[model samples]
Target: MTVILKKVPESEKYILRNFCSLYLHELSNFTMNLDVGEDGIFHYVELDNFWTVDGLSPYFIQLGGDIIGFILLLERPFLNKSNDYGINDFFILNKYKGKGLAFQAVEKLFKEKQGQYFVIQVAENRRAIAFWKKVYNRLNIETHERQDIIDDELCLIQTFKI
Candidate 1:
């Protein structure tokens, strides 16, 4: 039942790549008709730059000793506000869903990286919107929400200072 966010090591780039492909595949179901590519891989050309990017971090969500998912964080200020961070990508394997594991993992992630945080869910994904609302309620933090068009798709943005 131990959930941990382990920083993805450079030596394990393949691990992250594999997980990213899976994450993208899952997201495609809820996203705006995203293509998973001919080879069924979501190629992120910028993944190699994660190590060098100043505020970007990629972490593996490890439950016990197994890698179950990943979260990509961006530590950039939002709307000129300092110390604002973004949860760019988060995913828990389909096999691991409906088990309260994501809540534990996200709670730990927020506790360790406390600051102004922003989370975005695709407007089409009702389940994700509901899940985030529950998470925020469990955390007992007040949040401001708005809808915005990002990358040609409308997204539900939640902002909270933790």
Candidate 2:
């Protein structure tokens, strides 16, 4: 299958909304709680209410003209000691897993963009940590240090030098 990556558009917002809603629903069911955090500090994220139009410049990973995943990125901060370009909320549909498509997509991102580093934060839980490690290892990405924790969940920060 051919995967095409493109910037997000108005027409595709509904598709993104639907996909995230379903993903979060599944996550909630797996966690047995809608709140993704404990100790009264929950991550108040409504899938429908997510995705800021201004804060994020979104991109969709489309295979055979079908959107299978998305990635969000932020501009690199000027004062940071290390190279770090923010990446958030990357997800691929379950049907497309294990195809190496995500690796290809990220490789393309580094190839096309002039950025020096690609930074992403993943929850330090089982599935997410495993997935991120696998992807980064497959893509030969590495990190210098771990980032902060969010809502009691260890947030793993990885950076890929481009």
Off by over 4 Å in 2: 29-55, 76-84, 116-124
TM-score quality measure for candidate 2: 0.72
In angstroms, the error of model 2 at 28 is 3.3
Local accuracy of candidate 2 as per-residue lDDT tens digits, 4-79: 7898776677777666665565455434345534543334354333354344556888888888888765544432
Please provide, for model 1 over 79-160, each residue's C-alpha lDDT reduced to its tens digit, 9 standing for 90 to 100: 3455468888888998998899999889999889888888999998887888899998988989999999987888999989
The models' CA-based lDDT, in order, is 0.85, 0.63
TM-score against truth, every candidate: 0.91, 0.72
Q: What stretches of model 1 exceed 4 Å from their correct place?
A: 76-83
The C-alpha local distance difference test score for the whole of candidate 2 amounts to 0.63
